[model samples]
Target: MAERQGIGEPRFERERQDDAQASISWLPRRLDADAAEPKLRRFGAERFEPARLSLWAMAIGRDPERPLAWLLAADHLPRALLIAGALDPRPRQDEEALVLDGGRQPTQAQFERWWLWERLARPKRWSLRVQPATLRAVALPLWLGYSRGRSGAGQERKTRLIVLSGLSGEALGALKPAVLAGLRERTKAQTDAFRSGVPEGTPEPG
Candidate 1:
């Protein structure tokens, strides 16, 4: 188990400022921005921001028996399962953070397909009769570091986005594309909704 930071800490003040615009239900995060700052600095980011990514938790195994749990990213496209170990999720509100709800919730059928593919790679697990035992929404904490291009000082400094897992404090280079795609889609949906005078959180038109 990882150590969790209490909400009363002074470091939360900076996180609150960084994520003032977004909020959502989140799983209790073990790592805080302050604790992840030193690693984030290595990216040479001009500034670091805190954010959250929506994920779906599903238990897949024989019904009536305890099943293995998995976390799937809520991105528009299907992605490999995230490497999250045992989680003790609890509701903790009043924590301000930028929650990215840009991805679609993966359907049960999608999970089945992914499971089959995964099993094919592991022949020994083929006999395991698995199914989605339960499904629910959850959020993973993330840190976004914004760094400028290393071009000449006279040249414009284009900002680059670097993502890291707030849980293990590891850089998520492979998931960067998916994260960027989700952000773009979310921004587009919000813009479209605003233009049509629709309230925020309204489902985008099909």
Candidate 2:
């Protein structure tokens, strides 16, 4: 009789596509679908007409159950596009920052947001030369799941993008504003950190 493989056994060979999507698990929190549609539509129309207006989102607190909304720029733009997902240990490195193996082949939407966010993050090095309105043309959605601090049961930690079994829009709406605000602040801080070339007052990247 043949011996059966254990649960931990490698079942299928890891395909590139499979690995690409796997990185999305880093931010597995369900995006605000209801808000996403309207925000994308409204912003799509007002991306330009002005400059300096940008998008922001951030996470906060120890073991945060959800993201906090810190800032929403008054600037508007085209609809934000949803991409497959963002890869881990960002800044893909190849001959010179090439996409990594098993990395998600970003759609057109992903390309836009990726370019914009990266520019925003390193404004000193990168340029915000594009018109504000055109910024909307490239915003992409990233669904992610990640864990901070300790793991295992009874762990003092936070898990993002968990599947809510039966939460209604109304229930989620109650917390939307705060969450969005927190996310905005977090986003801004991230960009600023990159600009400062010292995230959280840490050493500059070499």
TM-score of each: 0.65, 0.18
For candidate 2, lDDT tens digit of each residue in 1-206? Answer: 01123356455422322433333222222335454334333323211110011122221112223222111111121222122212112321122111111111323333345445644665652532222211111111221122243477877664332111011112222222333343565577677878877546676657
Each model's Cα RMSD: 13.0, 21.8
| Span of 10 residues, lowest total lDDT, candidate 2 | 45-54
- Residue 174 CA error for candidate 2 (Å)? 1.9
TM-score of candidate 1 on Cα atoms, chains taken together: 0.65
Q: For each candidate, what is the lDDT?
A: 0.63, 0.28
- lDDT score for candidate 2 against the true structure: 0.28
Whose lDDT is greatest here?
A: 1
Error of 1 at 78 (Å): 4.3
User: Residue-wise lDDT of candidate 1 within 91-205, one digit each (tens)?
Assistant: 6456677666535555556667777777788787566543444455557678888888777868986888888887778897755766687678679878877768976577865
